[model samples]
Target: MDEVLTCENSRVKFFPIMMYAMVMGMSGLTIMYQKAALWLGFTDMIGHLLMMVSTTLFVVISLIYLSKYIKYTPMVKKEFSHPIRLNFFAAISISMLMLAIIYKEVNVNVASMFWYTGTVLHFYLTMYTISFWINNNQELDHSNPAWFIPVVGNVLVPVGGVGFASQGVLMYFFSCGIFFWVILFAILLNRIIFHHQLAVKFMPTMFILIAPPAVGFLAYYKMYGVIDVFATMLFNLALFFTLLVAFMYKNFIKIKFFISWWAFVFPLAAMSISAMLMYHETKDVILLSLSYVMVGVTTMVISVVMYQTVSHVLKGEICVQE
Candidate 1:
């Protein structure tokens, strides 16, 4: 009985990290899938593949976390006890259904029916984020500050919603949202840097934190075309600098088995793709070509590194002592 209790305690301790990783993974996958959808013309086989991959991962992780965390008390089992998680799960389901509905509209009145359902889905996600994630964060006991990633990611959902609903009204709103979250994340990045002065000495967390919003800004541009190219490009440039520092300091060597390393690839790739799409629209031939080339090349290189890191971590070759 005592051993079983000890095992349960260990599981509880791991619950936070597992939840954090899963949230980050979901965020990365969502950003990647949006780009993949664009790349494949939204109707291509590749788009379907990307959607399937992202959806499967999200659902699986959510279920796993739910199973791990949901209480089975007599009162809770009655079905009204876990409203937040249940509502989030429901929002994801509705969002998926709406995405599928939009998928069938490709080339058939693309603009008219497309944005409404997507906007609704985004709003639902935004509601869930505000009502559940942020409100509950204080309740979760986490050692590392990295847990804030999901919170910021959740907040950005509304910007996407607003952008989708009305470009004129929502464009700056979306950009402001990106700016806000990036600032908050920057503070978190600094704290991580302060503490882990040597652990991730080679890799700076700032770039990874900034990459998503950069991607978001570019995505918003593609959706609304309201922002200046230089502004968005500058954000990406900052990200590039951060990545450069990370590679140089962290010894950008290939190590098989770290899942978190793969996390880096998705954001950069999505941003590159968004930049490419924006360049095409702005008629900047050189920049467009550069974006495409970098997207492919960097993804190829980073992917190999991420896969190796994952393998190493899984095999216990690169353990980080807490």
Candidate 2:
């Protein structure tokens, strides 16, 4: 019984807040199918089912994490303060942001509630994270693509916020998200080139590099409703990063599974959504074909990750101390 509460088998006491990332992934998948149903003339059935699953998981995960917080305040505090783990705190806000997008089609009232709450909470998290960075002397190894988790939520605002909020308000979030993306890119690139290679566990997070520009494209397209030069740049850059990650498949395939693998889901979904947007704008057959490929790949990737996560959970592998 002591071992059940205190040892590596302690699921509740050791529950990681990072579980929120799953909601982000599943939500992205839901939105991707929603886009597919509308734009590609596919049925909305898949999107609807995914929406139910994502929302259910979000509620369940939130309750579990909240229990962990109440029962193990010290552990929760430590996770919140750790330089790397601290970044995932934004995933909570991001999950809310994703949920806002998910519900925008089905229920305006529910969507608005999530949007206002997520928007307010995301801004606070962003400010807190930046402040933490300013005050703390961060180690270089702690610099991974996961750092973008906070900034990505900002770029993502306009995608869901355009109808709910004023243009200027949306612009504020977009501007901060885009500006820091470049700033953080330089820092992340330097660490990857001149410093130590990322530990194997973090290798999956490299896929996160594909997200900002892809989400930027969607957000920008939503704001402007035009596929201008800047929109083109953001979309292509996201595609380039997708190719870059694909080329490094060997690096990813060998690494043992970490919960961090959820890092792959949203970015790929973003790229799929971006491709669908590009096809919507250009009406290009090539891009339409590419969108189908992306949708298929994103579906496969998320499904595989979900299977792995469940397998690990039943085996008592997840929520163990790292």
TM per candidate comes to 0.57, 0.96
Query: For residues 84-186, could you state the per-residue lDDT of candidate 2 as single tens digits?
Result: 9888999988888889999998998899998899999899989988899989999998999889988756999998997899999999999999999999999
Q: How far is candidate 1 from the true structure (C-alpha RMSD, Å)?
A: 8.4
Per-residue lDDT tens digits of candidate 1, residues 122-196?
Answer: 455445544764565533212122332333333333333442345554454355446646565565556555544
Superposed by TM-score, candidate 2 places the C-alpha of residue 155 at a distance from the truth, in angstroms, of: 0.5
For model 1, the local distance difference test gives: 0.44
lDDT of 2: 0.88
The positional error of residue 294 in candidate 1, measured at the CA in angstroms, is 3.4
Candidate 1: residue 220 Cα off by (Å): 3.9
Q: What is the C-alpha lDDT of each candidate?
A: 0.44, 0.88
> Which 10-residue window in model 2 sums to the lowest lDDT?
1-10
- lDDT top scorer: 2
Distance from true location, Cα of 170 in model 2, Å:
0.5
